[model samples]
Target: MLLKEPRLNFTDVMNRKAQEKGIQLDNDQQRLIRHLETLAETLLRRRAAFAGLYLWGQPGRGKSFIVDSFFAALPLAQKKRAHFHTFFRELHQQLNGQGLDAALLELMGEARLLCFDEFHLHDIGDAMLVKRLIALAIARNVALIFTSNYPPRALLANPLYHDRFVPSIALIERHMTVMALNGPRDYRQQATGHGVFSEGAYLWPASAARRQALGLPDASGAVALTVGHRTLHAASSPGEFLHFTFAGLCEAPTAVMDYLALCEGHERWFLDGVPPLARVSPAAQQRFINLVDVLYDQQRRLFIAAACPLTELVAGVEQEDIARTASRLSQLTTE
Candidate 1:
């Protein structure tokens, strides 16, 4: 009898496992995956195409999982995958020793196939830097994959603030094939129902509960929560949970910096109410979305909110800001 041979198509196996894992390997995703597999196979055969894939979706849509799994299946020497925060933090830290340009150039040079998870920007300060890094990545012909809640058109929204990086946005659009994955139900909803999430993960503590939990001293005055030695004054109200006057935080209205400072030592916060704004402009709303994005990327805290559930709080926000906030809030659930 002739011996039977076992044939395996790794791409097919990956697609099957991806579907089984509840990832939304939809038509677009499947197409992209097939294209990617083709590119990889081509590279193995002839090393011709320098392929890049940008995967985007709202939170809970499995952007991270699919890209990560895909990269993992690739040969170790051929891939470099990084969380967006990790890349920035490492780049920033390296600046002390190698200088900014050097560090960025080094990172771009190191990765032949790069995957950036939770890619976003709020502060225009970082926007220009991102623009430069992306340019370097493309120049090197690196096969890049980025996972973001926002699609490519929204990648660098409010470019007026990032005027210097307009060219960079143009470059990213030029290089990447942007794809969006939308779903019928939130995957996080299933997790929440199963008790896979811990209540304290994103709980926004009422002022009273926080004070009691931390054993803070009361003097009939506003309570102070310290982050990296910076003090945020919050008031204690009965049954209101830990309370903060939004106006106070936005008094000077330095949106990004203040929240960065406020969230310095913690990953999550429990906000008591919607920000105090008589009429919120699109810019201001974007800032709020940025704040949530940063907090969620850190993945250290979960918010327990009172004014609204996560979805509604960001729903009425303008079109530009909607994707950013909804993408983040979509991952959250009420405890």
Candidate 2:
């Protein structure tokens, strides 16, 4: 027997849940809800008015909450929702294993709808790959809905590689119902929610006394561990924690793929010696941002020791996604 999803408007379902959690949908969020409701109707009625939906905005805008609610209420039997980076990580492996068309077909299976959160493109290589992903989904008429911090115009935004993604941008514009929930409230920064991610801790000016009192593994005991082809030193505590220095983890040429691979093996992660973003090089800042995104997506517990408070550290950074990093970091409760 196919289970029936309640026929509530996406707004009612989202608002009721949000209220219980002390999150009220602002005007912009509600506007997006109305749009989502329309999309849901289109899907429910078997109408192909749009191939997908894209919601883009700054961090903490409750994009995840809203989209999850909509997805949960969806009656479709074949649907999948994933964090963008996490999905791409798997997609890359699959593409390497089974060529382009075969990989997508295997991934898509019988899914009628796919929802991706934290959709973004910081590298041109990923952008080119995603371009194919989007194009294939369109050709097969697989619906894709995305929640991103970057607008379509801003994706693959490196000036040197921007032109390469125009076709993907055109595909998105023509096929998807792109909505902006650039709301005033960044619900993530509020620090009131509870989750595996929320139970994590943050320490400012992580003094020696602080690390000791928190029972964190000493960085002095860091042993060299191989990640992919590179050897990085991190303190391993039993099977629970893997600790690294910011310089060793982010300052080096560690890739997001490394973080994804490492995170699967370790449940708890700690990073020490994080200087304020204003003091760090742009490349290092981006690495840190990518690290946080991976951790947040994996819902792994993270402990961060920084030279200064997160507020001061994130201030003066020009990275567009830094706000997202800060917003996610904001969810960390003080230890």
Superposed model 2: Cα runs more than 4 Å off: 1-8, 48-50, 228-230, 236-239
Evaluated against the true structure, the overall lDDT of model 2 is 0.82
For each candidate, the alpha-carbon lDDT, in order, equals 0.58, 0.82
lDDT of 1 by residue, 1-335 (tens): 97553222446766777667655466756766666676566444435445666777776665665576667666546567776756776677677777667988777665678888878765676787787777766666667788887766566577577566567667767777777776654565554322221333232433567536644323344676664446666645322233454433434243444555555544435444454232456555655655565565554344443354454555555545466455455555433
TM-score per model over all chains? 0.68, 0.92
Candidate 2 per-residue lDDT over residues 97-145, each given as its tens digit: 5787788678878887889989989789788778887887877767789
Model 1, stretches more than 4 Å misplaced? 1-10, 16-19, 22-24, 39-49, 57-60, 77-79, 83-86, 96-99, 121-125, 159-166, 182-268, 274-284
Number of clashes recorded per candidate: 12, 2
